[model samples]
Target: MTAPAKTYTLLDAAGRPYRSTTKGLWGGHRGSRIYGRLDCPTALLALARSTGYAHRRVFFTDEATAAAAGFRPCGACCKDRYRTWKTAQENGERWNP
Candidate 1:
């Protein structure tokens, strides 16, 4: 018997669809890669936004690991959003995380 294809909720700069690996410690390029220059948390947030994930925590990990898990640099794709998130990280801001 064969196992089903493992799928990941990956996204691209323009908020498009693609698949990532079910494996860990991923870096540079994969076979017929789907997502383009997007990261995990950012992808998750984007997915939540478009597909209505409606979860509490967008990602439950540190920035680096979260990114390594497939999250893109929020500073890039989500610039304004990143700035806002950064501010929220500091001091007391409404809409925590």
Candidate 2:
């Protein structure tokens, strides 16, 4: 008999949750709506400190999905993307990615 396949819960472009065999490529905070690398230092620090960040943790299939879900890039991990997002926000323009 074959064992059941493992699955991970990830958020879609619409911020809806779904189960997939593939793991998420990016991580985010649902409350803050900020996404970044799965190995982001700031996120890891928060996780280590047990600041309830894990309770609001979310996972994304990719950056595009995260952006489409109304999430901004993390300045600590995704500096270049965060700069672009920040500039767009400051100029009252929508960020494409």
Candidate 3:
């Protein structure tokens, strides 16, 4: 049997609502990033680590908000979709593709 998901409620930039597992982390350091308090998931951070968009990838205080804002899952630690992303990158489907 699997455990129930934890409840995570928090506010994000633009005053949007969100939820997440463990808190996210910083992708980069910049003053313009109003949501610096926010955090990106480790999985998402991994993707950012292996790509050109490293600077853009980061933790958001509210994860659901990040996802809704167009942020995708991180590929590195996220084993499930890692391969999917690897294939995409190889085929040039999402490498700034």
Candidate 4:
């Protein structure tokens, strides 16, 4: 008998959750709309502090999906990307990545 496949919850470009066989490559926060690496210090700190961060936790397959979902790069983990995103936001330009 074959074992059942394990599925993961991932967010699409529309920020909707779906089941996938592949795990998400990035982590995000639903309320804050911020995405970052799985090892992001800020996110870890929030989680460690028991601040209910887990309830708002989200996952994305890639940066493009996160961006399309209206999420921004995290300043703490994705410094360079955040700088670019911040500049684009300040200039009233759409961030492509």
The better-scoring model by lDDT among 1 and 4 is: 4
Error of 2 at 83 (Å): 0.3
**What are the TM-scores, per candidate, against the unseen true structure?**
0.27, 0.95, 0.29, 0.96
For model 2, what is the alpha-carbon lDDT of residue 13? 94
Given candidate 1, what's the lDDT at residue 71?
A: 39
Structural RMSD, model 2: 1.0
Q: Sorted on TM-score, highest at the top, how do the candidates line up?
A: 4, 2, 3, 1
What are the per-residue Cα lDDT tens digits for candidate 4 across 8-72? Answer: 99999999999999999999999999999999999999999977899999999999999999999
Q: Provide the lowest-lDDT 10-residue window in model 4.
A: 46-55
Q: On residues 1-97, what C-alpha lDDT tens digit does candidate 2 reach at each position?
A: 9999999999999999999999999999999999999999999999999869999999998999999999999999999999999999999999987
The candidate that wins on TM-score is 4
Q: In candidate 2, list every pair of residues with a backbone clash.
A: none
Candidate with better lDDT, 1 vs 2: 2
> For every candidate structure, what is the RMSD over all alpha carbons to the true structure, in angstroms?
12.1, 1.0, 11.0, 0.9
Task: Report, for every candidate in turn, its global Cα lDDT versus the true structure.
Answer: 0.40, 0.96, 0.44, 0.96
| Deviation of model 4 at 41, angstroms | 1.1
For residues 1-97, could you state the per-residue lDDT of candidate 1 as single tens digits? 9998886543333334456554322221222121223354654555567544333223221234433334333454546645765676575664222
- Quote model 4's TM-score: 0.96
Off by over 4 Å in 2: none
Instruction: Indicate whether candidate 2 or candidate 4 has the larger TM-score.
Output: 4
